[model samples]
Target: MTLRVYLFVFKSRGYIHIVNIFNQMSSDGVTKYKYEYIIVGAGTAGQTIAAGLPSKDVLILEAGGYTTSLLDIPILTPILQKSDFDWSYETVPQPNSCLGLRQQRSRWPMGKGYGGSQILNNMIWNVGHHEDYRGWFSPEEDYNYERDILPYFRESEAEHQPTILKHRTKLAEAFMNATKEYGYDDSFKVPHLTQRNGKRWNMAHENHENNLSHHLVLNAFVMHLLFDRTSINRVTGLVYEKNGFEFEILATKGVILSAGAIGTPLILLSSGIGPKKELINTTVTFRKDLPVGHNLQDHVTTGLDLILLNDTLGMRPWEVFTLNSFYQYFVNGDGPLTMNGCEVVGFLNSTNKSKNWDLGFMVLPIGASADAGIHFKQILNIKDNTWSQYFDPLTSQQSVSILPILLHPKSRGQITLKDDVILIDPKYLTHEDDVDLIVTGIRIIEQLIEMPSMRRLGAELNPKPFPGCENYEFASNAYWKCYVRHLTLTAFHPVGTCKMGSSDDQSSVVNREFQVIGIENLFVVDASVMPNLPSGNPNAAVAMLAKKFLSVLLQSHREKPTNYDI
Candidate 1:
């Protein structure tokens, strides 16, 4: 059992050997360490880069703990989010959106363990649109969607398209058929994700064996990024806390923050590289005037529930308590264990003419098991009355749901420093136009249910009025608009805090190559670097983003070996 350890490369008799160190040590009781690359956040993007980066001199600092073998089962994801695997972040109360939710605050749950959200996310694999790829990067940057990124998307997926789902439901079929009238061909086009058979095949799946550098540290919380006092903008070291002990590790090449949208921006602001106004109250000395926490974008949705013909008899209650279910999963790698919440998706643009991959409006299925209502209330922190009205019925009496999502919202929010955690002000439904667009989307869903195929399946809108919307009739457009506001929920897709663009763009935080503006040896390579949020779920896109950055990093290193320096 040979363990690949990371310290530094040494040439002995014309051979490079990696020396394993329990901890870099000296008689001083504390050890000083240096790596070529230090990546913050062992989330989806961080692990991807750490697994593929050519250099063995890399260290990944994950704020949370390690990902255990339990993450391999898809259904256990819900349980994981409530456990220590989650960062357990909640947003500040919103004045506009989430009027029906508890305290009107959106709870932002991010995976804190090694695999990040990939271990806990609803496993849906989607490579957004061609225009989305162009939109996400700066115009001057040559990011070839087909040549560079698309192939990687294909490389990672073992896609089980919605049409072939073995556990297909009648409601899902009806949803697919109903959308055809509105020019949506495949309402049943949900794409299964980073899984092979029934197990999760995330970016961190094979990482244990092949990671060239075993420099990955879990249970390690990065307190602050250390820079040379001699060169204020030149990032040179990282200060992190692990097991109640703190240490500073040096970096020779650079530091990358793939710590996710929320975690990344907070680190940047704390490191004194965000907007001057934002850092005014913080103790961090302002390093650059970049808008590190502005342009925060997320995909919000308005849900429309339904009552299935079988009276929810066919619903697979999110059950994991039995030995039979465990035996079924362990022996065959199939059954309820393989299900990743929802099993179908219907992606659409407003015009109803864009390519299938393009995003605009999504009528996606959010699997409604018997126990799902309980999970939603706990995970989303829904109010008791709100739960009784909206989701509680879906428990045993009703099942299957389609949420009309606001794919691109004009509304923007900001992330600021809290005492320890980051403050997320999603400002959901703040933009008037965003609310209007989603109303139009719900109308389409209302019409879709009227289609003969859907109607035959008894797929009718749940008649109960939402808790606060007792004034308007459920059938009216005005009622739906109010519904959108009351039930506004994120697709859990957040991006664009550290936007990428050329220096000419004042709002830009990082350049096309993903380098921070005015800061040397500092880069951000996660969803936060997206100039624009893609029109679809961003898990797969985040992985591709890591691949693209790794290619760039490697290529740049080859082109100018010793020049990626301050």
Candidate 2:
């Protein structure tokens, strides 16, 4: 039988639609499909929730177009970093980092397309130390890693090799053995490698390829939440806009906001679900006066660039032979295609007093160009925009950038709305501890470069000239601090704008169950709900949270029917 298909593209607003040949029957004898859940933002957390949920009518609303280009999914991040897929958010003037660089806008690289940030990010899979969670929720709460969250972690992970899996088990055993000997267990199991079939398993593409029954919509921006007052504080539907025209999607059960840190809070504030004083000033009417856009946190990262004498371990052709490797991957599911760049990592404390490291180190096999700063600068539109024009003036030379992250910064920032637009003014390093932590972190990287593995690679520090370093004292702590302030940027782990906590907790926006406190049927299940930033990359934690919250939503559904009048 010959089939007819219709495709629609909205030019002015950038949206596309596909009308299939087969017409499926609905209850009203119409050829349409209705959804039980409508999820907004098909990014990291959004993709997870969509994949984990049971077989139901699910619809995902994303604002960006789709692309399957190899350039869109490059193994080395610099290629993708310069692509148009990144959202590229810039920070307001950070006084601590960038040497008083005005509007030192860092490249946020939130994927504007299908896979979300995972599609555009560095693709590093870090879970951080177990104590990071304990420190955030301990003594007062009954949240235990082994009892509550470990099984979910195991379920979600798909390790690369059996030997690697065995090594993880051995690491756990070693920690236990050390505890028996020293009467104290401080170390925790590192995160299982997040590779699928030897390739970086972007959750969006994974779902689309594996789960054919699911519906994944790209370039559909959710503009507002549709509420039914008769249902008593429940979100019955959603009002989304595509190509300048608004459409309503009725959800039989719930609407899940799995949009990441920035998107989630911005949606809430735009939907009139934020601080009373702030909402009253804007055109959006007040729905809930909760702290929707407060408690912003992100890991501050600074890079120590080192020039390598030999081609021992810096961007080699074998490391990122994309086209050939991808062809091999599709045929046999093996090769360099499976690697996520960051192979080895270490978590250590800069000071001897702390048990866990507030600083992290990621080892990249290849060195980037000295002009690497140009990629970040262009992506964020730093020069043409309001931000200061600061780029590495040095000529293009091969150098490895050792990224040191300030894991537990004391400084806090906020995301507020002005004239209905999302304004991210992350007041980075306003506190003395944040500055000190970053400084100490720089010292730690200096020590790591002295390691046998790095030394063998002939890694020599790049003595690049900076504004205040006229003396060229490379080893001096003062010189290092000057460099850190000028180079430090976000680790791409912005979180906690819509924190989850108890009612009395003034900083809390959502509750323990991930529901917005004041708003009925409104819940946030993304990185924004985190009370604090984790000590490492947040991708794993964000996915784990989505799984945990899915269970919570299901249990709540089972215990209490949605039809019941509250």
RMSD of each: 8.9, 8.2
For lDDT, the strongest prediction is 1
Report the lDDT tens digits of candidate 2 across residue range 481-559: 6666666667678989998888667778888778888666667888898888877688777777777787887788789
Clashing pairs in 1: none
Q: Assess every candidate by TM-score.
A: 0.87, 0.80
Name the runs in model 2 displaced over 4 angstroms: 1-34, 69-76, 100-102, 135-141, 158-193, 230-232, 304-339, 352-355, 366-377, 380-396, 468-474, 564-566
Provide the lowest-lDDT 10-residue window in model 2. Answer: 1-10
**In candidate 1, which residue ranges exceed 4 Å CA deviation?**
1-32, 135-144, 147-166, 181-183, 186-188, 304-310, 316-324, 352-369, 418-421, 563-566
lDDT of each: 0.70, 0.61
